[model samples]
Target: MNTTKAQILDGKALAKKIQSDLQQKIATLEPNIGRPPGLAVLMVGDNPASAVYVRNKEKACSRVGIASVGKHFSAQVTQEELTAEIHRLNENDRVDGILVQLPLPDGLDSVALLHEIDPQKDADGLHPVNLGHLVRSETGLRSCTPAGVMKLLAEYNIALSGKKAVVVGRSILVGKPITLMLLEANATVTIAHSRTQDLTAVCRQADILVAAVGKPEMITPDMVKPGAVVIDVGINRVTDSDGKSRLVGDVAYDAVAEVASYITPVPGGIGPMTVAMLLSNTVLSYQEKMTI
Candidate 1:
């Protein structure tokens, strides 16, 4: 057991360090910027998960001295209203970042709404322009979760160049962007999705493996290669046989940790890192706007 246990990549610690650095940078720049960096999070309805996430973001902004210009709209709010709000925020001098909280309402078109936000002010970094910049290897705001994964990997000095990296799941959010990032770092990247054949064989070949498929504890120990660096980015809530509920990632933490050289915990891993990257992106936008 002792021999099998892997080193823990403490994302929470790295996130704290990132936030502290951002706070210091904000303090130093706020004097010249003339106003605090502002992030506008627009939530259309009361999604419990989204509410929790928004609250955490607001609290993080407060800690970093950024202004939270949050807007909570009724579930019945129309698409045109949300688009107008995004336009207003795009033109607002005080707001550096704007993001529409995910899973907006049943009738809402999330992709359209995301497109409405100006790419320069897109805090989540999911806009087509930013994604295009990523594909072209140009500097641009990046999707928070994938950026967090890259940051975590960097914090531990994990070498990505020339390594075989496999990303399970091909979603634009975490999987696709992270694959591109790994490729940019010169790692040979393979992205596997639900339809992929021989998934276990594919995953075992990776020196660096990232799981972001949103399934709870789906990647077992057998799927992992010994001495591989494992980054789990899935956050899922599951109830135990005893009816106790808790969060878990796509990789089976305890089992996979034994086989992998490094591992990240469920709740304390990518979740905090995602929030940290959001703050970083906001600050970056703020700096860009102030200088221009």
Candidate 2:
């Protein structure tokens, strides 16, 4: 029943370009800095998907000339032990960034652990200091995923100024920060969540719609306004008719693509951009150390 076609946002291409630029920049700056930028990604337990993400981040760091000083711990690793490691990384001069992988095994106080990480080296940008800086529009490491969304939008020359932007979801990771970022770009932002009534009606009011609710195929064609730009930040794995697992974004891609003017594909879109931004933040922290 779909007929019209929309242009792909192509975040994958932009991410590749960003990594290449970072690689070159690192090559040039290493001599003066005396060491490559280092990012420590601490992962606990063996969540298969989390492992994959950590591995991809390490690979990206290596390609960009950032040192991966990451670590892994068993699911039963105690909070005290993790805190000690975070403290050590925070003080190490070589470590420019420190990130605690999320959804830590049960009984771990992730928020408390996040609080322990030095604000300067908070690579994931989830630290209160960094988040506060974001709220105040100061220069600091930003949440990678949200920053990536903005970067991709800019890369495609999409105008956000005065645009009606609706973001579905209220999570701190993507929704809130992204709303602030869009507001900074002069876009009018409305954050809709589960409590929002008539979600489709609210979504249809946007010139720019961002779906970060983590629900697969939640945003169908009818929810999208024709000619709107849709950014899908949700990645969900679901089995298909063939019983094969595949990744899908919050928006129903095929159906929505027929309505929106532009859209981002899940596997190739936000995933890579988030990693790229993380590396970028690590390098930023690295540069700051050199000037100190």
RMSD for each model, in Å, please? Answer: 1.1, 1.2
Angstrom error at residue 286, model 2: 0.3
lDDT of 1 by residue, 4-58 (tens): 5899999899999999999999999999988899999998888899999999999
lDDT of 2 by residue, 1-72 (tens): 235698899988999999999999899889998889999999999999999999999999888888999899
Q: How accurate locally, in lDDT, is each candidate?
A: 0.93, 0.94
At residue 230, candidate 2 shows an lDDT of 96
Show the colliding residue pairs in model 2: none
- Please give the TM-score that candidate 2 achieves against the real structure: 0.98
Lowest lDDT 10-mer window, candidate 2?
1-10
All candidates' TM-scores? 0.98, 0.98
